[model samples]
Target: MIIGIDPGQSGGIAGIDGDASYAVPMPLIGKDIDGHKIAAQLKSLTPDVVIIEKVHAMPKQGVSSTFKFGMGFGIVIGVCEALGIPYRLVTPQAWKKAVLAGTTKDKDAAIAFVRRAYPSIDLTPGRKRVPHDGMADAVCLAEYGRQIMGNISEVS
Candidate 1:
């Protein structure tokens, strides 16, 4: 299985195994990441490799928020390392360019792309009206990894 993570409170993690895929929002406790929960998920997934979205603080973000975001990102990396899972970082631009292609580089575009790409999966959870853009991006990131990795058995 290949895992992809979008690190932030609003972000999500996705696991893709062949034609199957699963996603969940980043686990959080208050403003901090729930590392234990994340670790549990990673353990269960037993990913062969992980793909994390390379992110940085935005120009206009507050210091406190930026620090919190950084902390979450760190937790993700730490969990992957603790599990001994190989991982790669892909920038939002690069993944979008590869997976999203001709579509607009925006949340809505990603959502639409996933809707078309994975029609079997339910992007919208609970009773919410809209699809989760974070989940969509996570899936796209996984797709990007899968595309680059090609056939895993042939990689060696």
Candidate 2:
């Protein structure tokens, strides 16, 4: 299994195979919260590898949000490390282009492309759409990792 994470001020986790998937939006925890909560959730999924959305320095308008996101990301990394699960960090543009090939430079267009590509997935319909962006992005990362690994036997 591949576990993909879209870190936010409030983080999200998604587990995916070619056809199977699960997503959850997790509340942000202060430094006081037990890191084991994340580890436990991930452990329950039995992920073989982890894909983390790389943290970047966003524009000033997003500075505070990005900072909190980074903290959450660190927790994710630590959990993955402790579990000895190998991980890779993928940039937003890289992940977006990989999943939204031939459709870049426009965020809305990329989102639309993902929705169109994975029509069977509940990525952008009704109230589910609210969490779709982050969840879909994580799914994209998982799919990308599967593609790179070049085999579905394990995923299946």
Compare the candidates by lDDT and give the number of the best one. 1
State the C-alpha lDDT per candidate.
0.84, 0.67
The residue-by-residue lDDT of candidate 1 on 10-113, one tens digit each, is 88888889899888777888867898998999898888888889889999999999998898899899998888888888789888988888888899988888
Q: lDDT per residue, candidate 2, 1-156, as tens digits?
A: 888787664445777765777666543456322467778988788887888888766676587666665767787889889988888888777666666677653546544654665556565444663535666666677766666666433321
Q: Alpha-carbon error at 4 in model 1, in Å?
A: 1.0
After superposition, candidate 2 runs with Cα above 4 Å error: 30-34, 61-66, 105-110, 117-120, 123-131, 151-156
Show the colliding residue pairs in model 2. Answer: none
Question: How many pairs of residues collide in model 2?
Answer: 0
Clashes of each: 0, 0
Candidate no. 1 TM-score: 0.92
